[model samples]
Target chain A: EPEVTQTPSHQVTQMGQEVILRCVPISNHLYFYWYRQILGQKVEFLVSFYNNEISEKSEIFDDQFSVERPDGSNFTLKIRSTKLEDSAMYFCASGGRETQYFGPGTRLLVL
Target chain B: AQTVTQSQPEMSVQEAETVTLSCTYDTSENNYYLFWYKQPPSRQMILVIRQEAYKQQNATENRFSVNFQKAAKSFSLKISDSQLGDTAMYFCAATGANSKLTFGKGITLSVRP
Candidate 1:
């Protein structure tokens, strides 16, 4: 079965640094999304992308966060300045309908 | 905002026994979808089951089945004849209401040999 893939299974970055988490969604899926889970917390939606633009974003997705579908297959999340609180597991997901298939997730560690 | 609640934080079952994980959601949308995702130690998210709110009958995928109570906004997962491999964090989620999913805190299931 085709599944979403994410890069840098684990990343370590200093505070105030930048990080880009990449994802390759299923080729035929139209909608893409990003979600995060702080240790022991529920998964929270960050943003949803369709038609190469954002359809909706949560309050947590502030100016420091941006998503891009730079190519037909790549979906990326860029954090301009990482904060210590930013440490969490970032999961990239995609689907044609409502049920999203998630990637293994990138564990971002902001020191 | 729609929210999914999994009241049970952790549960355990003997191998080959049946186990049920509870999930409930709050949503006013007329149409939506519910799902159960399994995240094992490998940290990979796998779809265990899915259900459409509009459908009256529950959905089943092999040993994995859902009891979706639409009016109550409840969707619970039942794993039958569980095996040791069933150990994982189970998350119940709701989506399609706003094109985003609301997930519960998750329930950790441990199967004893």
Candidate 2:
């Protein structure tokens, strides 16, 4: 079966540095999304992208965060300046309809 | 806005037995979809099953099935002949026209041999 793939299974960086988590969603899917999960918290939606523009975003998706399709296959999330609270698992997903598929996720740790 | 809820924080079942995890979602839209996803120790999210809100019949896949009560706003997952390999965290989700999914906190299930 085709699967969503993410790069850099794990990443560690300084608190004030910048980091980008990348994902390649299923080829045929149209909508893309970004979600994050704190160690013991529920997965929270960050933003949704469709037609090359952001369709919707949550309050947590502030100016510090941005997402771009960059290329035909690569969808990335860039954090302007990371903080300790930014440490978490970031998952990229895609869906043609309602049932979205998720990637393995990138575990990011900010020191 | 939609919200998916999994009341049970955790559940356990004996091998070969049947277990059910509860889920409830709040949505006013008549057209939508519900889904169940499984995450094992590797933490990879796997799609377990899906249900279209308008479909009256519940959806089943092998040992996994859903009890979708559209009127009651409930969608639950039942795993039959449970195995130790079935141990994982299960999440319930709902999506509307925006095509964005709202997920529940999730229920951790342990199938003991």
| Per-residue alpha-carbon lDDT of candidate 2 for residues A1-111, written as tens digits (9 for 90 to 100) | 888999889999998899999999999898999989888778888999999999999999998999999999999999989999999999999984568889999999999
Reference-based TM-score of each model: 0.98, 0.98
Residue pair clashes in candidate 2: none
Choose the strongest candidate by lDDT.
1
Q: Rate the local accuracy (lDDT) of all candidates.
A: 0.93, 0.92
What digit string (tens of lDDT, one per residue) describes model 2 on residues B1-113? 89999989999999999999999999988899999999898888888999999899999999999999988999999999999999999999888987877889999999988
Q: What is the lDDT of residue A61 in candidate 1?
A: 99
Candidate 2: stretches off by over 4 Å: none
Deviating ranges (above 4 Å) for candidate 1: none
Docking class of 1: medium
**lDDT for model 2, on a 0 to 1 scale?**
0.92
Worst 10 residues of 1 chain B by lDDT: B94-103
- Tens digit per residue, CA lDDT, model 1, A13-73: 9999999999999999989999999887888999999999999999999999999999889
